[model samples]
Target: MHSSSRLFPVALVSAELRGDLTEDVYRLKPNNSPDPSVELALTRLGLPGREQRGAPVILVHGSFSNRRFWYSPRAIGLGPYLARAGFDVWIPEMRGHGLSPRNLDYSRNSVAAYARFDLPAIAAFVVEQGGQAPHWIGHSLGGTSLAAALGGGYLAPEQVASVALFGSQVSRDYWALKLPPVVWSGRFLLKRMGVIPGPRLRRGPEDEPIGLALEALRWYGLFGRFGERGNDWWAGLAEVRAPVLAVSAEGDRQDPPWACRKLFEQFGSEVREYLCLGRRQGFSENFGHVEMLVSKAAQREVWPQVLHWLERQALPLQANGAGGAAQGG
Candidate 1:
């Protein structure tokens, strides 16, 4: 492991050889973000002796979830699946989630901070350790942050090989929330709460800082846009030329297929594809937002499709022209 005093300091906190994969946990403290004490945790998984076999993949979890979403306590999840399949997988826990310690400004954490600081630092650390740019795969809010980073130009195309988003949507047409009075009331209530209690709300496993709620409000509110700066994230999508894969589910009412498709259509990548998981699409079951990535059915049917996307993205850009077919149900 490298010394922790260097620029983009990273420390290997633990390592163990699980059943078929080697799991290593790392702590990174980049000096760029607002809170220097904030250390992000990244869990890396790879085959016992083939750590350098394929392109590295960084998996970002959604809001209210952590690294366990990718690699559960029992060692059977997408992270392990990819590691066993010969891909170096790294799962990063967002601030205050999972193994990452909460920052002093945890109450003020938002997608802007994540896109401008966290993702770039994680990508830099991965590139420094792996000696190459990594392919990024994000779920829900994780994907939203990835989109913000890409559109805001925080994560340049040269730093990323490809992008994949599962159940991620930027459009908001929720009837209740769209009402001006409801938006005002919701924003007023969220401003008083330091954080939204996810457990109490039965939303997920962890609490989300109110900052995220406020950010979402601005996005879904009247005249809402995507980034912190005046940068039009939705419009800026047309500038990203990296290969992209946007996956949606027919059962994902939280982020519907049409909304997910809208986000996909904004991408300027000539080599982008859309996938909708449903029984009508030949999938065994109608995958929901979480089921699209976590359910056992996903392991059996959807994982191979993800693997195929990764393999295709690994190809040179010049060779991707013939591979631009958008597939879904």
Candidate 2:
């Protein structure tokens, strides 16, 4: 069995996640000694200097993942890459994930809850801690929640400098419209393999049972899968006036490249960028949704594009890409 303790120096004090991916990052928790203070947690690298001009970027991981996913070593992952690219980066641990408090009844939660409770809390916490809004980036469900929270007034327009979304959808109606059988198949396989458990990541006195988070939300095997949608996030997407970047993977089954493209086209931002990572980019033979962040080719080719886009968006009117020392761990 994997050790329950954190393997990294920067990790949250009490956070206990499997050390498979998040071995190098530190976890950020809310200030202690407050009533109802189950605020979201943040795992960060690259502390900001006083001389920094841009707002820090906060990262939100998708369902079934906490801050650790961003630190996976198979690929250079987003946290370190963005840090090296000259931005202060933070990855949030949403409610019931990693070290954050768990819900008494997991059934009482919804995707909207994460947007309303988790994202807003983290955004407020960032401002309170850093005294400024942040450039937010999210993956899959993470992006969906941030978009919804911002649109819903949980996050003010000024609190967010910009947003970057990867492989995410923005509508409740999207489930029936897209998604292949393989997604369902994967869920079934995982369940058959006994991976379905509650949302908490910390192991209990006994070994923690495997759990299904994203696909387990709905009884029909679809509605509750991605997240609370349409109004929750789409409402936020429509209300958001900030600049946005939407990224999609060419052969992704969960949220297809077309979905990301559609989201960018529908957004109100005048300065939006859309990217489609294809097999030609070396993402992989079948680069499924999660592999992009863990593929070396994606680190070499795709990550730089995201970093450059972030720099340009942060500075305004600047459009240039810079190369990084793409080394493997």
Candidate 3:
């Protein structure tokens, strides 16, 4: 394949046909990458032999996870769900995860770097191809990076149609991490360990660099802020103007619903909605962090609602009837 495009120097890595969908994987070279070794992998999924009728959507996975979080080899998961619904679904694997090669300084890769370098490049490529702004859906730490990008001013509001975050949080209190001695000790151990093994831990297939853990701890340290250098991302969240949706699961102890809701409240977007997946919210059952979107219940109850949100910028009537509010975007 003569793969590189004119708008961006993305190289086509592979193409596979999965049932009714055509999957195209592209390698994106970051512009002014913090680590020159970084090259991102974006997998695009669409209907085969037909033009897509819906706008583009980007699915971002969280820490210690990969593209498989949103897709699988058998044409399963949310990426395929959106593709089948006529949405151009694209999934991006963060540096050193999935098809993306590890950076030379992989141990030091952090969310700040991803927000600053990777996401802008991705939005540019998708916009050029889709001929319009794309919607973004992120899970866990991926959502944190998305929020950081919008808060850090790397992504302009007009560049995206909407933003959705699942199982992501920053406001939850960690009293132990607030202490200096504990923070220092934790950081020391993490640096020595280097990386967190995903499979052994049963989190996912990709191992995450220790820098991600260190970054999280530092944010909870005494007087620590969420931004690098002197920037304050918490304060900057008030500057984001794009419509936002934050989804939380009742059983997600890792990122509890309260914390997720608090994070959503920080966003200054005038058009914003908060959703909780649980019996209280009329879901079949309370969802956990990983299964919130991966399970069959989500396929039956949540997926259609996601499509509704992308198309309408508002929650469905039944969602409001149950406890979820509709702040109509």
Candidate 4:
């Protein structure tokens, strides 16, 4: 039993052993006083016998994804990879995704809501349990939300030891979405459906609410800014002080390398590193969006580099190759 679970309004849903690792699942009540209900689930993994593991690292899945994206039931992927390396790995399945049950306002889920509410709760919880600031790794929209959390000041700088944004960028321009008529039309159509079927759309394994789609309206629409009600997250990114690493893939058409770089440059952190998962960076091949992290190539190539980043907080020695580290942690 986890001490945090016993102290907080949380339930130990399950405790399973997978080979040498232990997986503990917890269901937490919403930390919001107004919405004192359920919101999300966390899957924790750690070496069972280790008296003192490394620092905690929280992995946030992107849009149309869940905890399984980080750590599958078969005990594969980055979550387990970090766990085996003695890092306290935590995977959070956002509302209505994976182990998390949707609340009544399920259809109203948005990045703003996630940044302002869910992440704060998560950060507080992780700090409480791990007794230290946790490093954050987010994929795609997961990365975007984490950016929003930091930019909007919802997540304090001291609460974060470091942050890694994989395949994440908000600077990509959508000309069509910028038009008022187009934004209105798209919102109308999405509202009628309420949710986007991820599998049907061939996006991923999970479904997304209509509210998430409205981000384009806020970001690319008339007088667009990456925020709502006059809150500008894009400008806010300049205030972030945590050590930051931003990764972009050459083959990612969704969030191109240029745009990813643009977002990376927004961070005001004195310590910032930008990595490109492409041949130009000396990797074996030009890595695609999903393949950059989820493919077998990533397992063999990219994972070690990421693990090195988390462990050492330094940029990889890309000249050496995929599994290359910069002569340190």
lDDT of 2 by residue, 1-329 (tens): 33222321123344333222222233433332132434455665553333553457888888677766776533347776776666666777765677555544443445556666667656665665567788888888788777667666667776788888888774325454245574566555655645334344442211122232333324234443333444444434555678888777767888887666766665677776765666453333445587666577667766766777677663212222211111110
Worst 10 residues of 3 by lDDT: 320-329
Tens digits of lDDT, candidate 3, 215-238? 888787777777878678888998
What TM-score would every model get versus the actual structure? 0.92, 0.67, 0.96, 0.94
lDDT of 4 by residue, 171-260 (tens): 888888867888888988989998999999999999998888877677877677887776788889999989888888889999998898
Q: TM-score: which candidate is best?
A: 3
Ranking of predictions according to TM-score: 3, 4, 1, 2
Clashes of 1: 0
Q: Which ten residues in a row have the lowest lDDT in candidate 2?
A: 320-329
TM-score of candidate 2 versus the correct structure, residues matched by position: 0.67
| Global Cα RMSD, each model | 3.7, 9.2, 1.6, 2.9
Winner on TM-score (1 vs 3): 3
Q: lDDT per residue, candidate 1, 199-251, as tens digits?
A: 99998898989989888888877767776667877788889998899888889
Kindly indicate the candidate among 2 and 3 with the higher lDDT: 3
Looking at model 4, which ten-residue stretch has the lowest summed lDDT?
A: 320-329
- Give me the runs in candidate 2 sitting further than 4 Å from their true place: 1-39, 47-54, 73-76, 171-195, 198-236, 279-286, 314-329
